[model samples]
Target: MRQMGRTNRARYLATFLLGYALSGLLTGTWTSVETLMDYFKYKPRILCVESKTKPYFAICPFHKEEDLLVSGSIRDTGIWDSDLTHLLKVALSLYKEAMLVDLGAFIGYFTLYAGALHHDVLAVEPSNSSFKRLRQGLLLNDFSATIKILNKAVSNKRSYVHMGKNQKLNLGKMHVNSEKDTDDRENALKNEMIETVTMNDLLEYIHVKQAIIKIDIEGYECKAMEMSTAFFKEVFVPFIFMEWLIIRTNMNSNETACTWTDAKRLVDYLTGLGYTPFAYHPVFTLLDPSAVLDWEIDNIFWQHKNAKSLLPYINLLRKVGPKYFDKMDQNQV
Candidate 1:
């Protein structure tokens, strides 16, 4: 009976391994086909291979001579890095000694890119599991020395926080803004406590020359911004981009603080502090403030009033086609 049981267990193990290998092959084959269909050239691709000489690196498609390579899992979103690099090049041209702060540094892909460009970087992430992956990416990309990783959530207050229950990342280190209506979203995840910090404290710790902040804290962007008022006042960060999405009417989540209503208020608040808000389009400049408040999907923003800040992007878009500019003007809120 014991010999028979062992044989059955071995058979089951072999079957499982075969199934896994088959699935992996099938997925890879499908991804290859999809890549060919969506792209005409390898220019949009960023390769990640096992190499001891350099941990991870990417060659700029637009400028082969200006490859901004680093250590990280480029396989996760190499295509996304293309978009990020384009944005970074523009930002760097604006600020000579730029200090980039990525508020929600998930997996550290964008952080590594910014850090590798010789910009001083500070990445703030709260989830231990997420931060683990982020740290690995930073180390793998060899960005450990330049990039400062802070494993804490930024909020309006500086103290220990209860992140509550979150199944999305399987970590309870997510921040909840009690000041807003976030009960439905919090309840969905289950509630627990986690560590927290304030923006003022973080800024004071990492004193830098210039800064550009990307705040994508899911929904806690409002609290993060409110807490970092000191930094906003002191530093002239030319850009402050956040994710604003229109969701179901029933979802009372603060995670969409960059939505139409919240973005209007936030943009107004920032501009009130002497910052000019500009709506960013991939093709051309649409300097309407209300357009951001009018968006139902995600959008980017330039906090400073420099009209030239978006000229290159605008020209790039216009070169694509006139329809891009027409649609942009039509979408203005």
Candidate 2:
């Protein structure tokens, strides 16, 4: 009996040790030595950047497929989506009076750049942690007054929502939980209840005549759009740029992050609004409304007929191919 007890204890200890090792390994998987070095070196600092035509301040970003175009691109360019950033500038110049409604503004790259140009802007971020970072980054600029920051998530209606975490991604990818989905009651209750605003409700805050809207709400954008029908009807949004990862139909739900049914609804809704979609390969190419799943663009512009006045600029940009603005050195990153 004594020998048997000894063997069992030994086995138990070995098993416990193995489990602990695996847990540490799994937790530290993404935290490579290089990532650790970068974290310590540049964790939280304001970067002064002269992005060609626009000089702005960017806050230290969290680890993201963004900390930014993601894959740690900020270390090189001190910017992400340079193509999209410049594109917004051009849109603002053409619209002149257009307000930039930057939803999911994520560290305020688009908002920072637009506000630096002295454009009226409303920037929204859902995550408290990310919202703090975004606000700090934007406020460090001289044109901070030009931007209005909101810490609530935008949904189809005003309500309380539980925010969900995608550990695989960064805070910018944090999303509103679908009422039916969450890990469990205990953790759900622990998570902060986020307030939501309908897109139409946003209008009361900004008297937007024409707007350049960027919505990147992870998978929740489809649900948010359901309530945004009124906003689209009321606002003259010439450029509605969105992340198609949540609405593309060609891929399975894993890739699109939404069902084919939801994707179809989103696409139909935009089309019914008389918006034509355009993507750029080497130049801006008009996309077939039904086939957004096949689009190869990084992001898309749903151009309404109202934006025809800006066609010459779009044509020129595409002719020049995609321009990448701001290649700052390590200190700026």
Q: Candidate 2: deviation at residue 120, Å?
A: 1.1
Q: What are the clashing pairs of model 2?
A: 65-70
Model 2 misplacement above 4 A: 1-53, 63-71, 180-190, 249-251, 254-257, 281-283, 309-311, 321-333
Candidate 2 accuracy as TM-score? 0.72
Q: Report RMSD (Å) for each prediction in the order shown.
A: 15.1, 14.9
For candidate 2, which ten residues in a row score worst on lDDT? 324-333
* TM-score (all chains, Cα) for each model: 0.61, 0.72
Residue lDDT tens for model 2, 22-124: 5357656332344223322322233222233345434435553533334245445565666676667667766778889999886777787778666888999
| Candidate 1 wrongly placed segments (more than 4 Å) | 1-77, 164-192, 246-263, 279-287, 290-293, 306-308, 317-333
Q: The CA-based lDDT of model 1 is what?
A: 0.52
lDDT of 2 at 320: 61
True lDDT of residue 104, candidate 1? 78
